[model samples]
Target: MSSSTPAAPITGAAPSSLCAREPHVPAERLVAEMVPPPRFDSVRFSTYIPDPNQPSQTEAVQVLETFAAGLGGAHATGAGRRGFFGFGRAAKAPKAPSGPRGVYLDGGYGVGKTHLLASLWHATPAAPELKAFGTFVELTNLVGALGFQQTVKTLSGHRLLCIDEFELDDPGDTVLVSTLLGKLVEAGVALAATSNTLPGKLGEGRFAAADFLREIQGLSAHFRTLRIDGEDYRHRGLPEAPAPYADEQVTRAAHATEGASLDAFPELLAHLAKVHPSRYGALTDGVKAVCLTGVVPVPDQSTALRLVVLADRLYDREVPVLASGVPFDELFSEEMLKGGYRKKYFRAISRLTALARDAKRLVR
Candidate 1:
């Protein structure tokens, strides 16, 4: 031990030997230990499924690489040596691009847009202080729970923010999200987002294009919009899976067998609203399977929205859903399907159609 090191403090629980060893530990190792691991450690570029047939695949790769470079700070170029000592002098620090640039990935459902966003989030070398990843719903929920300004304050600490499923369905959401993105960009937070809709056409059939455009005007200015063209990967040949529920037999539980059915009428919407949007991606929770009997028309816009969130969760988790009321397609009225939120409904249909096809019926 260094002579300058002080005697270790005595504690009842900790041994004197252990306390004494702390002084011997290197400061550099301690500093390294203090640095936390990346928040979205599970996502990475290597896990992204790339297709050579997709023309946008190359552009996507370049975008991620360049974004990563920007996060790491550009490397200084050519160096000239000095006279007498001939010691190499450090080059000037390259000026970082002025403001954070965002990338918006637009594509059809299940075209791996979210996967690419995750890859970018994972591959980017961001400081722990400057990174966060959340679905658009989750982030909106965050804003709802925490006021817009507070949410901005919390997220602005990060240099990069990655959002999945970035769609503007609600009028209020259009305003809130537009403001949030503007604030984030102003705060120098780079954004990477995945969505099923393009910028100019967002909230198209539901709200006035002028209003929606005004909302996203700031985002449109800074974000480089890229279109990802591909077929729906989730719609491929599906296997015949077992039923989500059974006949007349009734139960209040979430997951049930062939002889037992789970009530879907009043409870499904309740359950959907009960969970946090951040958890909407995994709303099934403890259930191994799910079946809904007494399925009826989704009455209001709020309920339809809740169902949209639920369907997204079930589809992402590959949870099968069984219904008894209206056909899955008719669950939402034609008006609702043609309304402003139709994009969400369309996505739900795409997913539910696949789920229903694979779902089994319980034998009486």
Candidate 2:
């Protein structure tokens, strides 16, 4: 027979010790802390500076307002319900005029489509239960995690769903999105989405002959498409490039930054693949300055996804990246565009271009 182990004496402060009590926090304050407003904290309409050169930009902002007004209703308080859930005096006020139920904000890379979508969400005042904001990639990822029907049912409660980077890179994703969009609309959910290509122009150059076009056609009808056109915002006022950095530097021991350089593209990718994002981010924490070489077209979907994470980290930290094998704009090959993560690729390209451009400018 085994003897039961005696419990150890409680060695820490007594339960009734004066230090044991947390400072008195009001119950109301505690409840408030538990629930917060939907994200998109960075984008606000008030800060969107209209490019004096592009008259269309002013119109784009107006479209964003209409999208926000539709779901938020008028006189909605707390920066369009982005803050506290409290129903203010205006909550009793009569509803404002409703606006468009569906809006598609289209533009080329770096043209601020995402900024507009974010602004609309932050400026709208849907009830806390009736609003959500996320990217197309995130939606697909969530569907993968929770299953399609469950995700749809969970999201259906929201009156407004703001999406960024609506892409059609895979037939499966197209089917899923079609079903989801159709159900959302049928349930009275308003959509405000941003994309690099117009609805009719989606899946071009990649799945041009795919049968999913029929579904896209049906979904497209729900949105009032608006093209926000201009030069690629990334290319404006960029610094000149220096001579290409040699690839041999990356093969050296200790991965020296003698030239303040980056590792070979393949090696960098291999390292990135082995770690999770938080660790990957920590690894690159000190990589404020580096040059990238052998930057050929992205080889595969997995690599492209890894590169997206790398690009996001680098961009957030304002790291300087120089390159050689390929231009930043041509980072992905035509073949890679057909993959399900094309939206991530597009985002990677935009971010890398901006990072490289800014890095050069800072160098000069």
Per-model lDDT:
0.61, 0.60
TM-scores of the models, in the order given: 0.69, 0.64
- Index of the highest-TM-score prediction: 1
* Candidate 2 residue-wise lDDT, 1-364, digit = tens: 8799974442322112111112333323322221112323576887777677877788989867755654554423223422111222232333321333478888777777767777777677766546666656556655665577877777776767777778776677777888988777655567778887788767666565357778877667667788887766666666543444444432221133332444567667766666543333345544445566688777777777778866755665566676657676677887666564566687787777776665543232
Cα lDDT tens digits for candidate 1, 1-364: 6779773442222111111111222322222222112222364666655566887866776767666556554221223211111113332433223333578888887777766776776666666545676667767767766677778887776667877778776678888888888777655567788787777677777666675676766556656787887777666445633333433432322223422224456565765565554455433443334556777788888888888877776766666565655567677899988777887888887778777665554233
Candidate 1: segments with Cα more than 4 A from true spot: 1-44, 73-100, 127-129, 239-261, 270-283, 316-327, 353-364
- Where model 2 places Cα greater than 4 Å from the true spot, the runs are 1-40, 73-100, 127-130, 208-210, 241-264, 271-294, 300-347, 360-364
